[model samples]
Target: MRCRIPETTLREALAAGATYAAIARAHGDDPAAVRARCVALDLSRSRTQGRIPPEPVLRVALAMDGVSVARLARAWGCHPDALSRAARRLGLPTDPVGRAALRGGR
Candidate 1:
């Protein structure tokens, strides 16, 4: 079947920051059947999800001499990779210097 979203519905959704693709998906698939065109979808989050600590807190933890990324991630309720990515993006080291040396990498 074809999809027909009312103009008011589309306008309201867009004004509320909903993307066209999101609205299209909500209207069901087969968008081409109705000649509906939507902006490309980007699935990545604008901000990372999970309980990543604030910069100062993360800095203190990363600054600790013997802390491991895995341990930090566990304590912070995030995956190790997520923590690492967040740290790297913030220009902080993902691994403590001591642990990096122990792992034989900088």
Candidate 2:
């Protein structure tokens, strides 16, 4: 049987960086069911072990000039590698990259 989770609840959990398995355990749903529902709804979140830093947090940190990923990672109390992994999942630049490079312009 498919598990049903409210969109709002799922989105909130996702925005909070909860993994599918974690959300499943918390809501008494099977992990596969949560994953299936997410796929059906076209909802996905990038995360590492434990709770990942929210997308907004990563975006703001990436947008800040003169801030290194390592520095931000330190401030966020997570390893730099974790942050990098999540950024890669979200297709955002984990390092400083020129706009040209990001857009394949150069």
Candidate 3:
């Protein structure tokens, strides 16, 4: 069965600083779908408002051998995807295990 999220809940969640993924999980929907809906409804978060780790710290973390993105993100108190994005922006190698984890493989 398809999950139907109420518009009021979406608005309230957005106002309470919940991310699209968070809203999606709470309402049993796909994050990408929620993000698209938010964009269509003009309820998405600001582009510059998310967490970004410091370059030096990210560089050090990326340099560590055999470290997964999820572990590093937890250590840095940020989301894995956010850390991964930061690593990509800094041209760092995201370990294969970490990439697999991101895809829910491990």
Candidate 4:
């Protein structure tokens, strides 16, 4: 037997920026079913809607000392690959240990 998701719970999850797959997992339903329901209800927010903006991420990368791209990506709720690309494009260092060493520390 399949579990039925309540409309209110679905709406609340979407409003809280939960992805379809996440919502489906929490509700014990299929991701496709959650996506279709969201579409029908006009409640879907883009996957990137609540994520940190790229420009600010770049700024943080440049301003922070000894921060790795992977660490920043985790903190900013984005992919490490995306942070690495942004750091490269912005001419910022991507390795934490190397950056620290360059700054005259471990």
Per lDDT, the best of the predicted structures is 2
Superposition error at 105 for model 4 (Å): 11
Model 3 lDDT tens row, 1-106:
3335766778899899898889888878999888877777777776435456788777666666667778877776667888778888876668766544544523
Q: RMSD of each candidate?
A: 8.2, 9.9, 8.2, 5.1
Q: Which portions of model 3 show Cα errors greater than 4 Å?
A: 1-8, 17-36, 45-49, 74-82, 96-106
Q: Candidate 1: deviation at residue 64, Å?
A: 0.9
TM-scores, all candidates, are: 0.44, 0.44, 0.46, 0.47
Q: Write the per-residue lDDT of candidate 1 for residues 9-32, one digit (tens) a residue.
A: 666666676655677788774545
Which pairs, if any, clash in model 2? Answer: none
Specify the poorest-scoring 10-residue window by lDDT in model 1: 38-47
- Tens digit of per-residue lDDT, candidate 4, span 1-106: 3336887999888778788889988878999888877777787665332254466556555456756666666777777776667667766566655455545523
Off by over 4 Å in 1: 1-49, 96-106
The candidate, 3 or 4, that scores higher on TM-score is 4
Against the hidden true structure, what lDDT does model 4 obtain?
Answer: 0.68
Q: Estimate the overall C-alpha local distance difference test score of candidate 2.
A: 0.76
Model 2 CA lDDT for position 36: 85
Clashing pairs in 3: none
- The 10 consecutive residues of candidate 2 with the worst lDDT sum are 97-106
RMSD of 3: 8.2
